[model samples]
Target: MRLKGKVALVAGAGTGIGAATARRFVAEGASVVLTGRRPGPLAEVAADLGEAALAVPADMADTAQAREAVRAGVERFGSLDVVIANAGGHGGNAVADTDDEDWRLSIESNLTTCFVTCREALPALVESKGAIVVVSSIAGLTAGPAVAGYVTTKHALVGLTRSIARDYGPRGVRVNCLCPGWVRTPMADEQMDELVERDGITRDEAYALVTKDVPLRRPATAEEIAAICLFLASPESAIMTGSVIVADGGATAVDLPTLAFA
Candidate 1:
C-alpha cells in the first residue's frame, strides 16, 4: 500500500468525489479523518469505513470550523500525511443576478474553505513532509457561461495550489491540484437540471450539448476522479507536485475544428 501508515484528512468527505477519495485512501491503508457540513452523511461514511475513518462534521466555509477540523484530525491520528481540500459547489447565480451574498457564498464555499484548511494543516503537513491535493475544475482553466462566481473561485484555487507548491516544494511539502472537467456527480446532475430548465432542452440533449466539446463524448465517473486523487496522494506520484492534473475526458485538449459539426 502506498499510504500504509499515513494519516489523511479529507474535507467534503460525505459524498461525491471526497467520499470516493476517502474510501479509496482507507482501502489503500491510510487512517482518514472525514469532514463535511452534514453530520449524518459524514458519520455514515465513517461508520462504513470502520475504524480506519473518523467523522468530524464541520462547516468548512467557516475559518474557525476548518481549523478545528484539522486539529481534530491531528488529534485522532497523531499525524497528518495528506490533506485533500475537496469541499466546493456551485452556489448558483448568474453574474447579472448574483448579489453580494452569492459572491461571498461562492468564495467561502470554494476558495476560502481551501485556504482555511490548508492554513491550519500546513504545520502538520510540513512536519510530516506530506502532500496537499486541491480539487479545482476545468472552469479554472477556461471561462464558463453563467457561473462567474464559481469559475472565479475555481480559477483562484489553481493559483493557490501553485503558490503553495512554490513555497513548500523545497520544504518537502508537495502541493498540487486536480482540474477535473464535468464529472458525473450529484452536483453535476443538479447543474444539468438547471441547464435543462434554463435552455428548454431535453436532459439527453443537454448532456450531449455539454459533452459536444469533449473528445471522449462523456463525463467522468466519480470513481475515475478518485483514482487520480489516490495516485496523487500515494507514493507513485512522489515526484509529481505543483501540477494540475486535468481529468476532463479530453475536454480541455481538443481543438474546435476537430469536432464533427451537425
Candidate 2:
C-alpha cells in the first residue's frame, strides 16, 4: 500500500473523480475524509469504503464549512497527509453571453472550493509533509468553445497550484495540478446530453464527436484519473511539486491545422 498509514481529505468526494480517488486512496490503505455539497452521495461513497472513510457534507466554497471539513478529518484521523481538491463544476456560455450569476457560480465551484480546501488543510499538510493534488481540467491550459467562466476559473487554478506549491514547498508540502481533457463523469455526461439533444445523436456518438481528433479517440474514465491522483498523492511523486500534469488522451498534442490531413 503506497499510502499505508496516511490520512487524506478529498474535498469533493461525492462523485466523479473525487469518489474514484477516495476509493483508490482507501485501497492504498489511506483513511479518507469525504466532503461535498451532497450528503447522499458522500454517505454512499463513505459506506462503500467502510470504516476507512468518513463523510462530511459541506459546501467547500464556503470558508467556514471548508475549515470544518478539515477539522473533522484531522479529528477522526489524527493527521491529514493528502488532499484531493476535486470539487468543481461546469458553467457559463461565451463571454458575451455569460451573466454575473453564471460567472460567480463558476468561480465559486471551480476556483473558490479548491482555494478554501487548500487553505484550510495547509496546516495539517505541513505537519505531515503531505502532498496535494488539485483537480483541474485541460481547459486550464487551453480554451474550449463557449465556456468563458470555466476556462477562466480553470486557468486560475493552475496559477493557484503553482503559488501554493512555491509558498508551501519549504514547509514540506508538495502541491500539483492535474488537467484532464475529458473524463466520462456524470458532469461530462451532462454536456454530452446537450450535444445529443442538439444534434439528434446518441450520447455515445456525442462523446465520439468531441474526441474524434484525440489520439486516444475516447474520453478518460474517472478511475483512470484517480490513478494519476494516487501517484501524485503518494511517495511516488515525493520530488514533484508545482507541476501541471496533463492527462488528456493527447487532445492538446494535436495541431488543429493538421487535423484535416488526418
Candidate 3:
C-alpha cells in the first residue's frame, strides 16, 4: 500500500478524475474525505470505498466549505497526509462572449477553489510533510481557440504550484500540478454531445475530430489520470515538487500546422 497510514482530502470527489483518484487512494490504503457539491454521488463513492472514505458534500468554490472539508478528514483520520485539489469544469466561452459573471465564476471554480483548498490543507500537510496535487488541464499549459478564462486560470495554476512549492518545500511540504488533456469524463462527454449537435456529426466522428490532434487517437481514462495523482501524493515522487506534469497523450507535443504531413 503506497499510502498505508495517510489521510487524504479530495475535492470534487463526486465524479470523473476526482472520484477515480479517491478510489485509487483508498485502494492504496489512505483514508479519504470526499468533498463535492453533489451529495448522492459523494455518498455512492464513499460507500464503494467502505470505511476508509468519508463523504463531505460541499461546494469547493466556497472557501469556508473547502477549509471544512480538510478539517473533516484530519478529524477522522488524525492527520491530513495528502490533498488533491482536483475539482474543476470547463468554462466554455469565447473571450468576447464571456460575461463578467461567466469569467468570475470560472475563476472562482477553477483557480480560487484550488487556492482555498491548498491554503486550508497546508498546516496539516506541513505537519505531516505531505504533498499537494493541483489538477490543471492541458488548457493551462497552452492555448485553446476560445477558452480564454480557462487558459488563463490553468496557466495560473502552474505558477501557483511553483510558488507554493518554493515557499513550503523548505518546511517539508511538497506541491505540484497535474495537467491532463482531454479525458473520458462526463465533462468531455458534454463537449462531444455539443459537437455532434452543432456540426450534425455522429458521436464517433465528433469524438475523432476532438481527438485528432492527440497522437494517441483517444482521451485518457479517469483511472489513468487518477493513477498519476496517486504518484504525486505518494512517497514515490518525494523528490518532485513545483513540477507541472502534463499527461495529455502527446496532444501538446504535436505541431498542429504540420499535422497533415505527419
Candidate 4:
C-alpha cells in the first residue's frame, strides 16, 4: 500500500487512462475523487470503487466546476494528497483544415482543463506536500500527422508542468508531466476505426501499422500508462518533479532516417 491513507483527485477519471489510474490508486490504498464530463461512466467508476471513490461530473475547463470538484474532494476525504490531471481529447485535422471551433475545443479540452483543475487543487496539494501528474501526450515532445491542434496543446502542457513545478516547488508541491504514445484506449480505437475504413484493414492491423516503427511494436495499454502514473504519484518518485516522462514504446527513440533502414 504505497498510498495508504492518501487521497487523490483524478480529473477525467471516467474512462481510459484516468479510469485505470483511479483503479490503480484505489488498489494501492488511496481514496480517489473522480470527475469527468460524462456522468454515467464517472458514476460507474466511482461505484465500482465503493466508498473509496466519489464521482463528480463536470467539465474541468469551467473554472467554477473545477473549483467545486477540488472542494468536494477535500471535503469528502479530509485531505488531498495527489492529483491526476488526465482530461484531454484529440483535435483532428491539419492547421489549414482545422477551423476556429476545432482549435478552441482542443485548447479547452486538452490544456484549459488541466490548467484549471491543477490551479484549483494547488492549495490542498501544498498543504499535504502532494504531487500533481499532468497527463500530456507523446505529441507534446513530437508532432503527429495532421493533428496540429492536438500537438500544439499537448506541447503547451509540458511548459505548464514545468511552470507549475517551479512555482510550487517551494510550496512543497511536486508537479510532473506524463507523455504516453499510442495508448490503446477508446479514443485510440476511433483512430483505428478510421484506418480500418480507409485501408480495408482490421482494427488490430491498423494498430500494428501505426506502431510498426516503435521498438516495442505495439501500442501501450491503459493499465501500462496507469502504472507509470502510480509511480509518479506515489512516494517512489518523491524526489522527482518538473520531469517529462515518455511512455511511448520507444517510438520517439528511433531516428526517422534509421527507420527506413529497419
Kindly report which residue stretches of model 4 are placed more than 4 angstroms away from their true locations once superposed: none
- For candidate 3, the lDDT comes to 0.90
Candidate with the larger TM-score of 1 and 4: 4
Model 3 lDDT tens row, 81-188: 988998877576899999999899889888988888899889998999999999999988898887888899989989989999999999999998999998888888
- Clash pairs for candidate 4: none
**87-149 in candidate 2: lDDT tens per residue?**
998666999999889989999999999999999999999999999999999999988889999
TM-score of model number 3: 0.96
Sort order, lDDT high to low: 4, 2, 3, 1
Single out the weakest 10-residue window by summed lDDT for candidate 4: 253-262
Q: What overall lDDT goes with each candidate model? A: 0.89, 0.94, 0.90, 0.94
Which lDDT tens digits does candidate 1 get at residues 1-262? 8789899999999988999999999988999999989999899999999989999899877878878888888888899999999998865667898999999989999999999889888999999999999999998898887889999999999999999999988989998899999887877888788889999998767777899878888888888998999899888899988899999999888876756663
- As for candidate 1, its clashing pairs are none
Q: In candidate 3, how many Å is residue 12 off? A: 0.6
TM-score of 2: 0.98
Full-model lDDT, candidate 2: 0.94
For model 2, what is the alpha-carbon lDDT of residue 145?
89
| Candidate 4, position 227, lDDT | 97
Decide which is better by lDDT, 1 or 4: 4
Better of 1 and 3 by TM-score: 3
Q: After superposition, how far is residue 83 of candidate 2 from its true place, in Å?
A: 0.4
